[model samples]
Target: MPLYWHLLKAVPSLQIIAHRIVWSALLVAGWLLWKYGRGWLRQTLAIPRAGWMLALSGTLIAFNWGLYIWAVNAGHVVETSLGYFINPLLNVVLGVAVLHERLNRVQWTAVAIASGGVLWLTANYGSFPWIALALAASFGSYGLIRKLVAVPPVRGLGVESLYLVLPALALLLWGESHGDGGFVAHGAVPAWGWGAAALLVFGGVLTALPLIGFADAVRRIPFSLVGLLQYIAPTLQLLCGVLVLGEAFDRDRAIGFAFIWVALAIYAVDGLLRNRAAPALPG
Candidate 1:
């Protein structure tokens, strides 16, 4: 992220993400080809079962990436933090709504308390926090879709990357037509420089690595424990937004965040007591 906006002065958010998908898809595809050869796509696709669901998951995850990059660069890092903060809670809602899953009283209480905080924040802000809501909803939906698919993490990502190839290519072409593409080999943008361009290419590897790790983590740990730990990312983002990015987070906003935090505490405790497992993300 620092490389894109701060150091390399990259192009628009869509372009940046498009480049990421291009490289990531290529990387994952190459690995799949070399490892699985003829059976690679066959094994990963698993149509009549997980195909449409994986495609939907792919779209949602890409949407999450593009929006997140936009939010960070648009100087809404704190709100981005807030979006991630509520992602797990949104997962709870999605599970119930989409998956027909049920919740216990503790979970219900947590949901109500979080809704109160979200409502309070929305009212206080006098407008819906679209960035936060978009982030949480997109990611939560992606997770839900991944839960329905039974592909391996790496292979699934490869297929998702496959699904995105056309759209990503189109975005890049559009950027080039407008003379706004920054990933060009002979451009003035810092990312166009050989060194920065190489790093930019490496972004694909960087992106997939975390998803791979997360896939492994969910497989090993209790879902509730995973829920307990998911806060680390958003918490750090919050601190970075407030301290590093210098976002305008005042007492009014803090009040809403406080409620959300309390709700998370209740949810986390409930998860610990229940020890339910969560589905792994396919990335």
Candidate 2:
């Protein structure tokens, strides 16, 4: 985590995102090749009418990555963390509004509690938690888009990166011409190589891990429980920001977090009740 903080410090947001996407595309592509072969790549590339639909998702994902990287780089890691905590609720709202999925009473209550927390945060801060809001909104929208799309996750990511790769490469070339490249120009050899390799692996590993976990949790647990755990990353980021970086944690923000905690508690209890009432799965 400290490593990640330092890593964020070392590179610009777009550069970090580009590296992450490139490595993620490579790693996921390799996995697909091993599992399904080049035919999978061809199929992914040949999505006829779906191309534009995917381009939209790709754009949202790019913004999400950019915002997250900016938060990390700009010393707003805690606020960024808060944003992720809000994302599940955003996803639920999207489901209700766009997919026409109906929320249970308990789910509604949970959303209300979460909304109160957000309201409290906004009111106390005298402005919306823009960092958090941007992160949550962009990511929630990205998730919604991904859900609507028919392509497999790995293939979708690969295609998205492929679409963006030319622009990314152009940026790299453009940066080099301006003598502002993060790769060789930023630091010393050992620092650059090891750091670069770590970043590449970090990009690929993070892409795969939470997604795999979410897939498993979705099958084993209720959506609400999965939603609750979505707080973990943000919580960790908040802690790291405060303890590690010593960022400001003011009274209103503290109160705001308190509200969010209360809301999460309400959400958790409501989920437990819902789960108790839900029919048991087949043996």
Candidate 3:
């Protein structure tokens, strides 16, 4: 995302998203065709149960991607960080509400502490963190839908890519016909530099790779752990904003982060205890 911010200096955010959809769909399509030959599309449609689920997931992830890309490029790097920071707690909340999953006292308390951290950040920022909230909500919903989806990771992603890119292709075509597009520019709107163009095409791979991992993880692991691990990406983003991008991180913000850390620690410890207590069965 930090890299995307640099790239966005030259490439438009919507264009980046368009290329992401187009290239990702092409790449995943090639892979599926190579391995499964002509049967891949049929396989995607074979599971009627997962079809609607995957479609919904595709829409959700697209929204999440578009928003994140815009947020990163718009100099809200730290705000994006807050969005991801809140994502896990939001996931916990969703698990309780959507999946009817119960949390232990410790885990529940962890969520409460995390909520406090969010509230503290909101107070310090002097307003409700709408961007953060939207990111968390959209992504958390994506995660929830994906859990119910039973498609294989690569194939599922391929299917989702197709859904996003078809519309993207239409948008690109519309822009090109008017002669003001990036990838297929004619006149009036000059094409991006070769370096930027190359990165734009490669955006597809960049976008799909993490999703492959996430699809696998959400299908296999407990969802809350998936949320917990999300801390890594946001933490890196926070560092990039403060250290690399040079965004201000005041003392009040530090206190807010401290609260989040405390919550994550409690959740981590609870997970450890539960794993240790569970009896191992024959594999």
TM-score of each: 0.84, 0.85, 0.91
Instruction: Give the better candidate number (1 or 2) by TM-score.
Output: 2
Q: Which residue pairs overlap in candidate 3's backbone? A: none
Model 1 regions more than 4 Å off = 1-10, 100-102, 173-178, 185-192, 215-228, 270-283
Of 1 and 3, the candidate ahead on TM-score is: 3
* TM-score result, candidate 2: 0.85
Q: Rank the candidates by TM-score, best first.
A: 3, 2, 1
* lDDT by residue for model 3 (207-266), tens: 888888888898897787787899889889998888987888889899999899999999
TM-score of 3: 0.91
Tens-place lDDT per residue, model 2, 123-194, is 776556887888888777766666666676667766776677677677756654665556655532235765
Q: Score candidate 1 by TM-score against the native.
A: 0.84
* Position 255, candidate 2: lDDT: 78
